[model samples]
Target: MRSSLHVLYLSLANLLITLSITLPSPVQTAGTVLVRRSDDGMWHPERYGGGAPKVNNPPSPGPALAASTIHPIPSPTLLEATGLIPFSAPLETTHPIPSSLPVEPKEPLRTIKEPEPHESPLISADKFNKAMTAANFPVPSSEQHVAFVASTKKAKITSALEAAMYLAHLLWESHGLQEVVERACVNSACPGSYISDLDVKGKRYFGRGYIQLTWAKNYLEASKGIYEDDRLLQHPEMVSENSTVSWETAAWYWGAKVHDAAASGNFGRTTAEINGPLECRGGWSGAEAARSRFRLFTTIAPIFGAPGPFLEAGCY
Candidate 1:
């Protein structure tokens, strides 16, 4: 025990001597220490710190170690997410080898997709309807309005202008006629003009279809020419129920020969031609029904680019 104490004191004194060596004037830190170091201020293989591999001067060739004396280098891949490489001691290998092959970079994560929306309404189905409504247009029937829209493309009528004019008159004939009579012809009663003349063979025929297919003779003649069936003379209400037949009858009256009075866009004159005998009998200004027809034409004409009424009458 006394000899072992003397040996421990010699070892401690040798450690103190090794630690007293200072860095040389040329020594500076690069990534790892590049300068050769010695213990006890003398040249020898005992480096103070775990020394770096030599740069300008390689380390001396070492003797092959016995297999049992070797240790595996710590793998860089063993690092935890804390970014620490756990090594209980200095990293060393049986032979100098590359530190864990250059760490491979990772790819980024994928994101979810979303739906896209449309930008403009120029190609929408209700584009025309919305525009006309914004302009405060009084569209008649949806069916008739569609006809007007279609006319802008292919023009089943002469033009959209003609379709507008045609639809305006039809609108008045079917929906606005009563209002016209109530507003102005209250005293004269335009529909009652043919009072006794309205019935034939016990089936009282009032104004029934577009433009009011009034009078039994008119119904019989229209049904024969337009439907090729005279049955409407006895059942005139069928005219109101069958829109196609009613409109066909009106078209027939419009295109049948020529009423010079309806020539061109003489709107007031057209009113006179269509129902003058009943409503315009008192003269233009007094003809409320004629004036109402003109009112509708004025509102609808511009939408279809129809020229304004070239000839003005007091009724318009």
Candidate 2:
């Protein structure tokens, strides 16, 4: 009976050991990743975490690893799922992209600089016509005023002093823009030398345009400078016939010869450049003409903002 009891006890112990070895391990679902023990004695992920549903589309296995060292191949989806490379955050209204970028200027830097001392805003038509009237000039039509202003701007004559001197010359020379040609030459009895130009089939280049542009050579040069051709020499009458051309020719002359002198604040120096040989000399006639030029400048200049007691009067 004792031997039989001992045999039963040994059988029970062996059965308990077999049951412990054969029964499965308890499944854990607490962590972020589902893992399993491998033959290599490493815990490897079976599936991603975050309650992701199981699918048949398991990731392909990487190259075989050695016993001790292992590096899991990071698939793009695996990296995203594992929080290694996190998903982009949701866009917010708090921060927005800019609509426009800074742009560089197309013009040269020098061209955009502030106006110089000699520069000023152009005078208005009302002011110009009023100044003309004040200087005993005819109240020029609006069209005439526009033509003159355009011409002056084209020549870059923007200063009040220069415009004052220029208009004075015009007033004296053209008699307030009333006469286009020299009155002395009106009857074709202009001095013989004035008629000596053989060009233009007997068309004389005697004192035409607002400044009374004289000489065939002057007509030719003005034509080249203004029209880029011989139009003025070919047809000198165009200067008188076309009002715009008349004003432009005078502006061209002022810009080329008289601008610097007028800018110097010397009225006599300006007259010397225009008709120095005749008008700048101190004869009775010259003095009278100088006085007239001075008087006209004084009258019209103040209207254009030129301060007076202007002392610069005579060329001599």
Candidate 3:
């Protein structure tokens, strides 16, 4: 009897191990395996001859799903169409099943600010006057306007800002009224001998034109810059006789040397360019003239669409 019992126990142990390997992992609803110590000291499937329900094959994993940022709950219509739930069941209500869907928290929307549009480089004569008035500079005359537009066009002063600054300089120079003819020099005896090379036998070349192209040499140089001619040196009154000649000579000075000063919007620098060393030189008169020019720059800045002539206007 002892030998028989040992054989039966061994057999039972073998069966249990074989059953565990064949079956899938035990799940919550799946029935549990049972055992009984036989009277003969042997074990089989179970006391009543029952075992885990026979499974032909393990369940296959479905196709992999792509990950998503916003996890959308499956709509009831989708589940119904797929026959996931009972056909007799009611459709999805406004309220969702708590366990069926994830609670997606909302995020705030973002926005951005845009910059405002700016003005163009150039403006019309009408607009130019309006801007000058806004800056407290008086409007130019019709004749002054004609001369300004004509001369500046020739000098490549295309922008309204450029025209405005050029007009401002002319205003201060001769108040838009220049004596184009050569006049008496600082000294009566030195009528036209400002430059030794200009002191010709029968010629008088003193201050003339808008900004006054003075000295015999200046007349010669200015005519070359104006129209590439030297007749102005011999007959200097041609600048006064011809309106175009007068404006052209002035434009030549502006485009040649004083253009950069105007670009800076510093009237003092432009003034210094016109009258050497007088801007921040000499005595009281020189100092006063310099101050006045600096102020003019600030005042005319707005006409050119500048924020202001608030930049440093010192001699440098």
Best-performing candidate as measured by TM-score: 2
> Model 1's lDDT to the true fold?
0.50
Worst 10 residues of 3 by lDDT: 58-67
TM-score of 2: 0.59
- lDDT (tens digit, per residue) of candidate 2 on 1-316: 9999987877676455335432222321122233333565343444222223232221223223222222222344544445444322122223332223223368765656776676434767777889988876678888877777777776668777777888889888898888889888888737575654446776778889898898888898888888899989989999899988899899888888888887778898888889888877858798678877888888888888876557565486
> Largest lDDT belongs to which candidate?
2
Stretches of candidate 1 exceeding 4 Å from the true structure: 1-142, 146-157, 176-200, 257-261, 283-286, 313-316
lDDT per residue (tens digit) for residues 167-190 in model 3: 666555554354454345534634
TM-score head-to-head 1 vs 2, winner: 2
Q: How would you order the candidates by TM-score, starting with the best?
A: 2, 3, 1
Runs of candidate 3 exceeding 4 Å displacement: 1-123, 127-141, 158-161, 178-195, 310-316
Residue range with the least summed lDDT across 10 consecutive positions in model 2: 22-31
lDDT tens string, model 1, 58-151?
Answer: 2223222221212233345533333443223242323444433455677867776766775432112353344345334543455744443433
Candidates, ranked, lDDT: 2, 3, 1
lDDT of 2 at 103: 39
